[model samples]
Target: MGTAQAAQAAQTTQTAQTAQAAQTTQSAQAPQTANAADPGMEQAPIAYVGGMPPVMDHMIYSHALLDEFEARADGHGGQFRYDGQAWFGTDYDKLWLKSEGTVGTDGRFGDGDHEALYDHAISRYFDVQSGVRVDLDNGPTRAWGAVGVEGLALYFFQLEATTYFSDRGAAARLQGSYDLLLTNRLILQPQVEMNVYSTNDRARGNGRGLSDIDTGLRLRYEWHRKIAPYLGVTYTSSFDQAASMARTRGRQVHALTVTAGLRLWF
Candidate 1:
């Protein structure tokens, strides 16, 4: 009976040892089993990512207009007008549209001009742009190819220079403006625009040389960045044959007037 009891105890010990060895082997092989089951587990740290979004695309569809509304002198009579440009897109590329015209008291939209442009940033402060321009009234419905540059100069001044070309001829326009901040919300802006031509278009009453110039000084108080009311003084003058054409139409070649209007953006 003593021998039989010793043999039974040894058998129990061997069975326990076998169970412990099986558990040890499973622990060592568990990670290898998982890696074989999922091939991605081995390559998870080095998987490639492709086709990312454009670096500049995160800022989309921001738009603004620096000058949008006004009333000005045309002759002994006068006209209300809105001249504005708006742009939208990412910082690197954008679409631009500009429109201006007189709203006649006689219920006509006269002297209308419109342009559509694509703007590409070439430097930190400037863009190169190209587009089409259409003169809607006062001239034949003429379309021209336009190329231009618009930018900040000397940090505080805004400037634009553009040339237009069509079968009739080529013309150029230059514009500049500076803002004087009287306070956080009060601003004084002095703006100037000049137009020149390469040939005469009698139907449109445009001259071949320096044709006309407009200069204005405006003071505005902005309740917000999106809106402002302004009062200003403006002077417009014609030169060379352009002046003669104005005289022939009995229109004032040079006029000074007061302008009161709003500047708005969204």
Candidate 2:
């Protein structure tokens, strides 16, 4: 099993799959919390769905010098997010992981459909992560970010922590992705991701008590080169009892967003 100690589960690594199940797993297991304006920014929408559970054994290793810009709707509020991630791997299992950070600006309406950002604000933050995969007789399994000592793919759990100006907390993510290869060059992937918030903005009496879920699916044709690109659709949803309360208290939200984008690796 290969697990990185300092990788953020939010970062993605472009890995080709060999089948539909793997494609579906890759799409279903990614984080989608950021954007709607840019095609490259919008990935799987599951990152904002709030209460969905993390998928198992999914990991994305990002380049150390890459950045992404994204825009999306948060419930009724529109926001833009930007992220950058870098990766490192060890010889042990060829295990690779990445670190990521993000910043967001809001442009959504206020409580009464008034001017956008009337009472809302923009913020910036960063997170740390790590992940690993395991090979088993029954199946290939893994864990990312703070993987505990249980289950068949004991090393596939993903971990993340965010520290913002007004809110600071940590979350544990579980996800897995596999692929279906079509002639060794064509493939389909599915992914699932679950996010559990260990802390929320408890100060100033604001914040949802918990976190959300994110998932994705994608298909691609690989040329067996140093760089590859692919296209796919994504879905997102959220769940948190505390978030409900925060909504009731007049917070900004969008609830859902569907997007398309390309995936690349070198």
Best by lDDT: 1
Q: TM-score of every model?
A: 0.77, 0.40
**Candidate number with greatest TM-score:** 1
Question: What digit string (tens of lDDT, one per residue) describes model 2 on residues 150-180?
Answer: 1123243322332222124344445455566
Q: What is the lDDT of residue 53 in candidate 1?
A: 41
Off by over 4 Å in 1: 1-58, 73-75
On the 0 to 100 scale, the lDDT of residue 217 in model 1 is 95
RMSD of each: 11.8, 30.5
Model 2 score (lDDT): 0.38
lDDT of each: 0.87, 0.38
The ten-residue window of minimal lDDT in model 1 covers 45-54
Candidate 1 residue-wise lDDT at 242: 90
Model 1 scores what on Cα lDDT?
A: 0.87
lDDT of 1 by residue, 9-109 (tens): 99999999999999999999998999889878765555445745445455888776848498775447777878888888888899999988878666677
